[model samples]
Target: MISTTVAAVVTRFAPSPTGQLHAGHAFSAIRAHDFARERGGRFLLRIEDIDPGRSRAVFVKGIEDDLRWLGLGWDGEVVHQSARFEAYRGALGALGSAGLLYPCFCTRADIAQAASAPHGPEGLFYPGTCRALDPAVRERRMESEPHAWRIAMDKAVEQTGRLHWHDEETGEVTADPLRFGDVVLARKDAPASYHLAVTVDDAWQRVTDVVRGADLFEATHIHRLLQALLGLPTPRYHHHPLLTDAGGERLAKRRGSESLANLRENGADPAALAEALRRGEMPAL
Candidate 1:
């Protein structure tokens, strides 16, 4: 269990094994590492390879190597999301038992075609077609057709009342999880969605501080709600500014941003790169 004491800090650098570590990843990792180390706390590494279709073992190895080369070592054994299916199952079961979860059988195209579909932080919010389904129909579909599990946002919020989380940069902020309408907790193809897995991981690992890019700031609202629902602790957060390239585009794997391995292969100095990232400065690319 994580200490609730204000002095003990625990931070983690979680990376998905779907791509190489780019400069933005380096910056995020460095921030988490420095935060924990400077506070004489524990720093952890977590592998979010829950998406089996896109995750690769080779990418996992590359992640560790890149972090090592950057001189950011972690504490204890690394946590892998794929290995925690049973835990996620338990979390889902608890929420399901509470009647706060519903089967969502809507496909992406189905949602996109809905004229009434609303937009949210993640994209087009789920139209909630299956939210009020007949119990018999939901049971029949569960036994036959594959379906994702979505949290009943209204019910969950009612149970948890008002919620909030502290951000190191922004101070206290109110949570608005309803922005993502009926967000999926367990995906049809995966055991758990990003929101569920991440919430469970942080609580299980006893993370006291969450450090990541600003892009995930909105997701924190949903996470805070989950923590309340699951009786988990709400950790302090630091959503650092995203690192961008010369053209002002944020470094992303899908955008083919230069990877740390590429920089190493090109004879760039790892020490110098680490120093630049530590100083909140982008190294020469």
Candidate 2:
């Protein structure tokens, strides 16, 4: 439940529970938590454990444990994306009923083989092959083949028209859903895609400001369009620079960036560590 504390600003630190919390996670979490705390507003922690196969309960516990060790206290009960499948289904149904989404049967190899496939921030986007299929053909294919749901960018644009969203770092940016080209709303592995779940959750939580890393800056364009389509309010975004290692490379779990658990176990002071990040100084673990 959203706190009726009447605080003017509300922010959140949402992390995927697929691995141990690292230094980069700490920086983003602390920045969001402090932004709310300093303004006498509410700070929220949301578990973005959308993928059931990869997300482990131990990792989820580790995330909360690390946040506690860092001295960050959120205002309300933590929210979990896994528990909100029905809500996501409802939103997906809403989009489908409005003819804004269509089923995509293309696999990774299928997408890669498509001619003239344009690339977006993530990589080669969907080429909308299945989108051009006749309704009978699409229905027939849906009967036997597993598929994902994708937004129809062109049709969606016609419905909503030109739109824009605000960003603190880059000022206002015009929304460009086409660049993403019919991004997935639901995949076979998860009930809801990151874009759909996040857009829905932010509005449900009444988050007024979004603070996170700059990597997801491009996704804001699609999120902005979803908000417009669903009639949800757009939150002010502040995409801060990603925390980097001593070599000036951004930290990542896939690349084996040192986890905060590893750092804390090595005798680093949590309070001091938080202060070090606030000072823009990378700590020597």
- On TM-score, the leading prediction is 1
**Which window of 10 residues has the lowest lDDT sum in candidate 1?**
1-10
State every prediction's TM-score relative to the real structure. 0.97, 0.96
Task: Record all residue pairs in model 2 with backbone atoms less than 3 Å apart, i.e. clashing.
Answer: none
- lDDT tens readout by residue for model 2, 1-285: 333233478999999999998888999998899988888889999999998888899988999999999999888899999999998998899999998989989999999998968787779977889888999999999999999999998899889999999899999899988888889999877779999999999989989899999999999989999988888888999999998987899999999999998887888899899998887677887
- The local lDDT score (0 to 100) that residue 216 gets in candidate 2 is 91
CA lDDT, every model vs. true structure: 0.92, 0.90
Q: Where does candidate 1 clash, by residue pair? A: none
Error of 2 at 169 (Å): 1.3
